[model samples]
Target: MDEQQCWEIIEAARDDAGQAWDHLDERLEHTLTRHLVKLSPPEVARFAEFFRALQHRVNREDLFMAAFLIHHGCDDDGFGDFRAGLVGLGRDWYTRALQDPDVLAEHPAVRARADISALMLAGFRYAPERALEELTGEEYDGYYDSGEPVRLDDPPPQAAPVPRRLEKLAALFPRQQAYLRELYPQLTE
Candidate 1:
């Protein structure tokens, strides 16, 4: 979809509430994903750069928390805040998320789960050093074999702090917390 069409969908969703909002949000995400898949290599590179730049400005923890909320059906105020954050960042973030939903996997909550983490890592062209640090040297090698220069024996990087908002959201949604714990026992610790 063109930029104008994308914005129009976003604008419509911004004012919508209840089921309408959910439908619109899904529609917006679908369109953005479609657009992302159709981009040329140069366009993909530009989008990736734009995504990285925007990532620096936003609370990535919050974004991941928002993704969890959206994923688990917590679509009230939290969804609104998450949607606003995406809209504020413009279409690039949407495109980036479509390109690599694992971008959200940077959050510790996401990393705690092996299945989710694996899926996220698969989206990445380059192995995320922090994510793989916990793995054995053999495990890392098995996961990614680009043959590029990388040190597998180094210590895993320190984890990023989980944002207060993410914590609060988790606390507020006990079901989500339970779901996470069920899938990833480490999250409860």
Candidate 2:
């Protein structure tokens, strides 16, 4: 499948899940897995490849800062899930986020400080791989080689004091840093 088709599948699953974030993980997994089951193994693999590529696109320091600000804090794995969450937002938002992660400040979930576990579930779900396993009765081996790089932009800076970190983050993403300051007063205090 092509990139647009891959996004269509994700968008379909998102639409199928509707407005509620409850059980979004399970609903999305079910919808994506069901859709993948209809495709041939190669097509399923292709879809996974596209997903990986898209994930790579958002694997940047500035976007990671956005995730960290939105979620309060994000570690290595949390960043992975954050990228998946960004993808789950669908193509246009994803594209805009790729260009400027501060746009994420507009999202309701980020604003409400709601349970965002479902948004982060895509990285953990591994739906395409799971579908491949179910289809072939074998584990999915389609993954980037060990040599493949994950970051598409600069790496995050070394750890430092919260205020100092905020300065750097504010420099990189002023809007997101401002959002974080407003949402979590204790952090700024």
Candidate 2: residue 5 lDDT (0-100):
85
Clashes within 3 Å, all models in order: 0, 0
- True-structure RMSD, every candidate: 14.3, 6.9
So what's the TM-score on candidate 1? 0.31
Writing each residue's lDDT as its tens digit, candidate 1 over 26-117 gives 44344444444454433433443333333333334444544564356433444444434445334544445434433544433334542222
Deviation from native of the Cα of residue 69 in model 1, angstroms: 4.4
Error of 2 at 60 (Å): 0.5
lDDT of 2 by residue, 121-176 (tens): 65334888888887888975664233433332333333323332344335545666
Distance (Å) between predicted and true CA of 9, model 2? Answer: 1.1
